[model samples]
Target: MQEAVIGLSHLFMTVFLCCFANFMVIPAITDVTMAALCPGKDKCSLAIYITGVQQAIIGLGSLVMPLVGKLSDTYGRKFMLTLPITFSIFPLVILAYSRTKWYFYAYYVLKTLIAMVTEGSVQFLALAYVADNVEESRRGSVFGIMSGFASSSFVFGNVSTRFLSTSATFQVAAAKSVIALLYMMVFLPESVVKYRTESTETDCLLEKPPTKTWKLFKTLPSVNDIICLLRTSPTFSKAAVVAFFSNMADVGLHASLMYYLKAQFHFNKDQFADLMIIVGIAGSISQITLTPILTPLIGDEKMLSTGLFFSCAHMIILSVAWAPWVPYAAAMISIVATFAQPCLRSIASKQTGPSEQGKAQGCITGICSFANIVSHLAFSPLTALFLSDNAPFRI
Candidate 1:
């Protein structure tokens, strides 16, 4: 029994680390799959459109993402982390079976719906759990380590799924998720500290029981509450804007990268996946090795500034140059940027009280989601217009 308890504790730590890693994978998976599945007639164009549409779908989910955070805060964190995984099983099965373009669209829509709960909320809850459990002195290291695992998972998942047949990829993804679910069920504990309240009325109104997660988001927080929160908290307001721009830049770069490859150097789907895998691995290393060491040394503000500056420089270089080393240079810069993410997240966490972490994270995700929606809507048509077979510049 003691051994079993010890084993479960270890499992919770693993799940805590890997849950966000799993969320980090959605983009890498979508990128590789669209590259494989999109029709060959104007393949680059179709791929961008498909990716954009998918992003827009996920963006809509992001708009409602904070509800999950708030519910988890009011109720419990473990349930929030588990809810999305439970909901995701069916859509992934559908995604696995889908072949036609209409089926692909349907699957993506389902994915978007599930992502609303999972990508933003699950991670927010998980981070709250971490903040609650880990000491402040070590929180940065813990977050850095979790980010490393998540990025590593992205690298491996991209390589493995990208190489597999679409059917095989789906099967593998389903299996991975099932394993994750089972681990959570058998081993993970409720990480939230117990809180006592007087009235059942508030509980009845707010508490979203784990079993009835389907109804979790049925009741909405008022628009006035949102506006008041934004106005009252400058940190939340500024974080929201930062979240939006950051996601816009991230999604725009991702959606355009494959086309940029084909347009500039004429690489195919497999080659692009390989490059992504390499870049993902580099990012994983940077987040693991460089972040923990650098963050404490330079602090979040200076570190984030330096990271963003380098990332912008790389984007400019990619926009202009198509040399053999361009991808390598770009990857290095992006890895530095990736290293900064967890640090920024930790800074955001410190801006709010412990109880409000979920809402704060949700606000950030919601803003970013809106940004992603805009970028996707604009990037697809813009890419098509700017880069045809006869265009002068690749970007």
Candidate 2:
């Protein structure tokens, strides 16, 4: 009962804190990029470059995710999870306190490197923990609840940004993560045990003893391990494909949306924050109510694909938004489109046996990291060029 409670609470708070930090940062990323790269006018190109550079650095860091995931398999989740979360703290504080261009550069380097260790894995680890604990048939609802936790927290984060300064938001976000780290250290239990370790055959009685804490640091899974899993597992392969494309769209959207909207619609921070709040509500409500009902009825794959189709629609609507209200209108698409990621995660978790969940989720995270590099680079330049005065279309 205590373990269950810990897992549930951990997921809820971790999702909330992560979403809070994320929402806190979304409005600021563009501004920070501008401040770091170009103080006055001519900010667009440098901002784009900063965004691309950040993603590229994180992409390099992401190479460790699969290894970390596999390490969770060998060393255990608690050790794997704690180090990244600890590494995460200082960077947030550094970013919050940034006053100079050099501070910005330091923040960027620390963020890119620190985040590479935890970026794709935190939520993945939480989801993997769910898979470790819950029964197979009911995992979708749990995943949805987790997603809803994120969205709901995003709603709160948006509210904070409405009144708070960028520095305040970053500080509060850092504090929230600190609370989470303390909570995990005190209460969270290891979901994986020696007897329950994943293996190829049934009646698999082979379980390696937990590696020593120092030894855990050196035990890293290679890129080949990730590739071999993809090559060997058909279900994992298909899920990886869906995750790749879906993340391509998501990463591209995240990197470009704020810059695009502010450039075209002249949205200030408050306006951008409100748009996100609306989108969050739409997703939160849907994932909480609609996805659970739909996942069991239509199946995760079909539901995921449907969500992706609507995601494409959401992007298209944003592209040609003619009026201020149009962006808000596009937010309604999130009602259905919110199903994509959680569903993909559920599908992937279901494909793997108990032992392989960490590896699988880590691979998905690695795919996301790779896609982030590509999408940020691709979208930053394109969005900048499109919004430039010299552009042909004049968006």
Task: State every prediction's TM-score relative to the real structure.
Answer: 0.81, 0.90
Residues 1-395, candidate 2: write the lDDT tens digits: 23553458765776577657666767655666676677764338667767777886787689567777767766667767788777777877887887468888888888887877778677888788788787778788788878888889888888888788878877887887787688777777777542355454212211344455666545665556666777766877888887877888887877777777777677777887889889999999998788878888898888888999999999999878898899999998999999999988997787666766777788888887887877877887887788787776766
Local distance difference test, each candidate: 0.63, 0.76
What is residue 211's positional error in candidate 1, in angstroms? 16
Predicted structure 1: lDDT: 0.63
Clashes of 1: 1
Candidate 1 RMSD to the correct structure: 5.5
Q: Which sections of candidate 1 miss by over 4 Å?
A: 1-38, 42-44, 194-220, 389-395
Model 1 Cα lDDT, one tens digit per residue, 236-277: 576566666777877787677667666666665456656667
lDDT of 1 at 308: 69
